[model samples]
Target: MKRRTFRAEVAHVNRPLGEALAAELGVPLEEAARLVDVGAVYVAGRRSRDARTRLSAGQVVTVVLEEGGQSPLAAAPGPAPTLRILHEDEDVIAVDKPAGMTAQPTEGRVGDSLADRVGEHLKRTAGLVHRLDRETSGVTVFGKTPEATTALAEEFREGRARKRYLAAVGPVALPPQGTIDLPLSKDPSRPGRWRATRAANGIPAFTEYRVLHAGKDFCLVELLPQTGRTHQLRAHLTALGAPILGDKRYAGAAQAGGIPAPRCLLHAQALELGHPRTGAPVRFEAPVPEDLARFFAAAGIQAPSGPIRPLEPPA
Candidate 1:
């Protein structure tokens, strides 16, 4: 099924979420809020269901019509695909998203989005409250209802949801701890891709990183993003002179180096959020993928001690 694309422009700046999305889609506020609440809309790929979310002018929003909802998308296939469900309850479910699998279907692409897979696993209706990049493997959370969805969504908006990423980079050169405060914007040369540009129009982005360990020819870096901007970590690392080892689009030597893996050397290691139903703290984690493991073996670096750590919020 082809996705109907809309290059929606925000005429009014920072208007409330319901009002802005309603106006943009020419729908009633109630219906628009309903769509937004159920993960039918995305703000630059991040889920934004809050009716009161402020909009910024020139922001491009994409609305993916839910399968059973009142939209133009085709009927969703039955028997949702299998996925690694790490945690589940009445309020929410968490899954270990694998590399190369999109969080949702896009124009002309038909396969199991994370939501589709989760839907099959859930006895009750389930909806994706957030997402990860196709190449990013790790924890992804979903909400079982609109109330849970809204609460979890607000946690993300308030920057209270904790996230930790594990990345392998080319021979690292920076200090053990530091923060990258670089502004990033889309690469004009390539639509749908992002780059670290100093253009005045760029959005403010920050990524805090620490060198977890350094080995013969690779460095294990821990990343924490303060802003959920597109390609923020990739762009910031590239600007920091230590582009992730296999990041082809953002790194210079990835292709020429003939790196064993074509996929980016980044992993969404962990996630922390409150339980939507119980309001209890919850967390999830995933270990490094096999390709990254093989890369380390090829580099002759000893594996880190201990089991992969469980997800935990900041102390």
Candidate 2:
């Protein structure tokens, strides 16, 4: 189904969010509230399910509408897709998350998220250790027991886990290897978006990249994020002037290296962390998806074979 998105900046304050959306979109207040009820509304780059939320001047609001003025998020529910299990043990369960599936359920949305699917598969509770963007596919782990969950969560909170991602971006003019150290925060002027900020109040984010292949119009690179922040890789790549292919939110090209790309070309290729139960180092790798493999072949670059080596210490 075709969908259209509308964004508006509030000029007046102290009004119900639904009322502001109705004025901006020329829809009834009830329709605007229904949009929020279905998770179709976003404020300041985050989804807001509360129609009664108070709006402030200069705040941005965004809504997605399907053809014929229906909320795109109000579609009929479907059965959860089977998961691709990478590894499972008494304490932890690792799965290869597919693109287009959210890591967790969103408020006011009716569908099974990755977490729901995992819990259903195991017939018990599963605690997510970390999260990935809905469009990013890769290895993600969950803890089965409370002890395991706390231990694993602590590892990530303490910055002891290592992550590596593969991405294809528009041709980069920078060096083959470099680092992006930028501060990021919500874009006050644009709803549902983040931007780099030079102000001290912005959150610090750091990402290191190494070019693996450079075509005439695109480049394949490996990304290592030292600090985990929302959309860190996507924002950092955009800051470097080489946004990932098909990343419409970041001004990426629809086609890269003479190939069509329908979604952001980014993959969480591998993850390494100490086991919560045994305290032993363990690594999980996800095979490159077919879409990425096709990109690699079109670019005349061979995909990495065998286990991916650990990322070198940042210079």
- Give stretches of model 2 more than 4 Å off: 1-79, 305-315
lDDT by residue for model 1 (132-241), tens: 88777888888888898889998899887878887777775787677788788888887766877676479899888777767656676778888898888888888877
Candidate 2 versus truth, CA RMSD in Å, comes to 7.9
lDDT of 1: 0.70
lDDT of 2 at 109: 36
TM per candidate comes to 0.67, 0.75
For TM-score, the strongest prediction is: 2
For all candidates, the clash counts are 1, 1
Summed over model 1, clashes come to 1
Looking at model 2, the pairs that clash are: 45-192
Q: What is the alpha-carbon lDDT of model 2 when measured against the actual structure?
A: 0.79
